[model samples]
Target chain A: MKYKYWRRSRVIPFTLLLSNLVYVSFGLDPAASAPLVADTAFTKSAFYDQNEQCFRCHGNSKYTYFNPVSEKDVSATMCENRVIHRNEFYTANHRSFACVDCHAAEYDTFPHPGQLRMEAPYNCIDCHGYDEQYAQYHFEEIEEEFQQSTHYTANGDAFTCWKCHNPHTYRINIRNSTSMQQSIAYDNQICLNCHSDFERFQLLSDREEINLIQKHEWLPNQGLHFSQVRCIECHARLNDSLMVAHRIMPKDKSVKRCVECHSQNSLLMSSLYKFQAKESRSDAGFLNSIILNDAFVIGANRNIILNRISLIVFFASLGLMLMHLLLRMIFKRND
Target chain B: MTEKVYHYPLWIRLWHVFNALLCLVLIVTGISMQFSEPNRSLVPFDLAVSIHNSAAILLIINYLYFLIVNRLSGNRMHYKITEKGYVKMLITQFRYYTLGIFRGEKTPFPVSEVRKFNPLQQFAYIVILYWFFPLIIITGLGLFFPEMIITRIFGISGLFLTDLFHILSGFVVSMFMIVHIYFCTMGTRLTSLFKGMINGWVEIH
Candidate 1:
């Protein structure tokens, strides 16, 4: 007892202590006890899946575009890159997924453990196919022509999709990473290979071939400083990395800007880029585009005035000199 | 026997001054026409067009007077007459300019009657008076016709062609004037030629 409290006090109270403690706690409820601090929510693992496992609605979990041969739906896996129409964007491999993945539209997660999905799944090819949709307006056709041309050979990576198309977009658009204007840097990469071959070619001719190339593109060999640079570079405005132009022009494969940007990277610039069977005038396809603009109209109007001024000045000055000469001859009569 | 020492007559001098002043006015008007804009048509367009046109006409009239008077005077240019030894004198003059002019030697081409102009003067005057001035006049007249000067003077056909001629000539003269002014300053001293034109007298040395 002395060891428990003090032996002298324990003699009077040991029996009462046991009886009162039992009485006080006998009516206490087990459910209503104060929760232990160790059981708090702050220390809990937060990966709540909302218990809505996505596979139930999306058909199958591990389905792929490659296995579409065994099944019809997954066959469209490769259909992601299938361009929809003549002017439609070349869709990359994107699959439609749950809306709560990327778009942070309404984030109610107390501690946002990860990203809130925003975009609906990419289900574009559920309607279109490569053979049915893109075969008509293929860059593949352009590349084939480029291959047959004298400018390029099959050894180049002309058949590849990444070479010609920006996979992130539905349309072929340029995006600026470094510059203010939308730059077709990879496209111009094609032009630089041949255009910058000045020092190698050693052609001493006065032809404007070299100058024209330098005029529209970058050439390190020539000491030209560009103020306006290329038409596409400035004309195309930047949207993130995407270069959208003020005018709604589709991604043309044959513009001068295209030549500068893409250069002879594709077979399209090759001498055999045309298949005479299908009428190979395809390299000239984009070049043949001539829109009658008003800028030239203004210049023509101004030139009329400019030409008249020049002619009048010439003739009037002529008459004055002649009058002087005639008078001089008449005055020489005294001699 | 009362031959005048000063060759420039009063009427010719007045016309020269008039033409020069008119050219200045035209330049000013042209400048104001393009005020605040490189190529914009503004309200001052009418004022500029009228002033430039009027000055142009006045210049042409004055130029005619100057041409007739200068030709009659036999003193439109500076020249030298080295008698029968003209070749020797010309060679000497050429050498003096090419070699001796640097050393402050006298000019071989001296002022004279009958052959008042040196080769350079004759060439320059021929270009300016014959080539340049006519180009401006034809162009100006063309423009003036567009403003209806041709309808009162020539008729419908003239009116139709006036603008065409005026515009074309104005362009030619403008180009010529640019080159002329540039060359005019290419003298040994830039201001010397200008001063010579200002007062009809230049120090021979």
Candidate 2:
């Protein structure tokens, strides 16, 4: 009886070891294979779960596919639409929020319902409008401005906030940015993404593809203007309530006059360089002196002291010349 | 017949006239650009830019011609300040303009083939043509090709400094033009010097 008990113990241990080996070789986790409960309990549990739970599948470049031949979970081709770069998401402005905060709780299911893909995304105003906490941001005014924009007028209900600003990555860079050039580059990218890209542009409008160079041919030094200033500097209507002007005017209404931005009271002072102007209010008594820190726009950046001195010298010279002419005429008459 | 001298050659006269025209155009357009307003402008901004740029280009070419001819020809001798008692000569010429001429005094400096300009005129021309003209040209070019300009100088935008220099040089040249024209009237007759530029001869009375 003791011998029989020893043999049974050995057999049971070997069986357990073999099962474990098979499970490991097949890349199967019992916990992962557990059936998903599509119920209130699961949704409530997922609501409190960390971002890693959602990132496990969506953040991965490759999707797991069960291969019958290999009897294992092998990596298949990347699902581009489903993939979200973990690093990018974490660094973005919305990083603090849980995925479920924006996404519906129904997405907690193992295989998210196909219907969820067609779910209407939240509008910017849905959360921000009339909220006292966000009152300072002026979302209501921005909404009003957006309603009047060409983008809204053209696309009607089809256009969303996501058209220009990607909720996943959008940041308040213009107001807070230290470098104007960097802000210009970042902000212009949003416009160029549609305006410069034919495929993306066609998604919004039925017009033929535009060549930016050909369109802006009248502007001297087109490349310099493009790099130095945001597209909205000339395109968008100025709004005092919003940090950025959302009321994008039609092409015909856009600012074309060079002096509009290249003057003592530059239009850019209220728009592209608004934050910079505010920060450096003490301008050494020079007209548009704040612009001199970042750029040198002709007609805009004049030194008050230099201008006054020049005027004085010019008038004095003119007066002396006039006197000289007067004396010459008098001497001639006397002679 | 009045005593006359051939002080200006065909090429010199041509260059001078073209230079004067370009300078006038540039000055007008430059002022318009400087004081341009969005609604009210002296010259329409677009037209001013085109005219200013074209005039600037022509001025550059005219200046080059002046420099090359001055280098190659004996005309350069007129610009040289080599005379003895030069400062005294300048003072005497100054006195002529300020007080002597009203008293019907003869000019301290006379027009001759060897002396195209008086001591004071020579000094003024040298400063304006050789110094201020080149300064305006270089700074104007810098403004034209803004990308090539230094991004900053002494913690100030280089373009701003360049523009300021261009304006200052332009102001000096403009003042010189006015004074130079007035000085030209002090010749034997009021219109004699004007006729001299056109005919390549000056009445030496």
Here the TM-score of candidate 2's chain B is 0.96
Model 2 agreement with the true structure over A1-335: per-residue lDDT tens digits? 32332243335533343344233222243531222111111333222257777877778877775667889988765587568776556444454456766676677775679987876676777655665656777989999899999999989879999888776666556655657778789899999999999988999899999999999999987877998889998999998776689999999999999999877899988998887777677558678877777887877877788788878987898898789889878987999
Give me the candidate number with maximum TM-score.
2
Question: Could you tally the backbone clashes for each prediction?
Answer: 78, 0
User: Model 2, stretches more than 4 Å misplaced?
Assistant: A1-49, A53-70, A79-83, A105-109, A329-335, B84-88
Model 2 chain A weakest lDDT span, ten residues long: A32-41
lDDT of 1 by residue, B1-205 (tens): 2221333446656776786668667756654442313234332444555667677877887888777777776545432233566556657755753455445555566434444444444455566677767866775565454333433334223432443454344444455555555434423454644555656543333
Which ranges of candidate 1 are over 4 A from the true structure? A1-335, B1-5, B31-43, B71-108, B113-115, B147-199
Q: Please write out the lDDT profile of model 2 over residues B24-132, one tens digit for every residue.
A: 8988888888888898788988889889988999888888989899879878888888889888898999988889877888888888757788888899999998899
Q: Enumerate residue pairs that collide in model 2.
A: none
Each prediction's TM-score against the native?
0.30, 0.85
Please report how far candidate 1 places residue A218 from its true position, in Å.
52
lDDT of each: 0.38, 0.78
lDDT winner among the candidates? 2
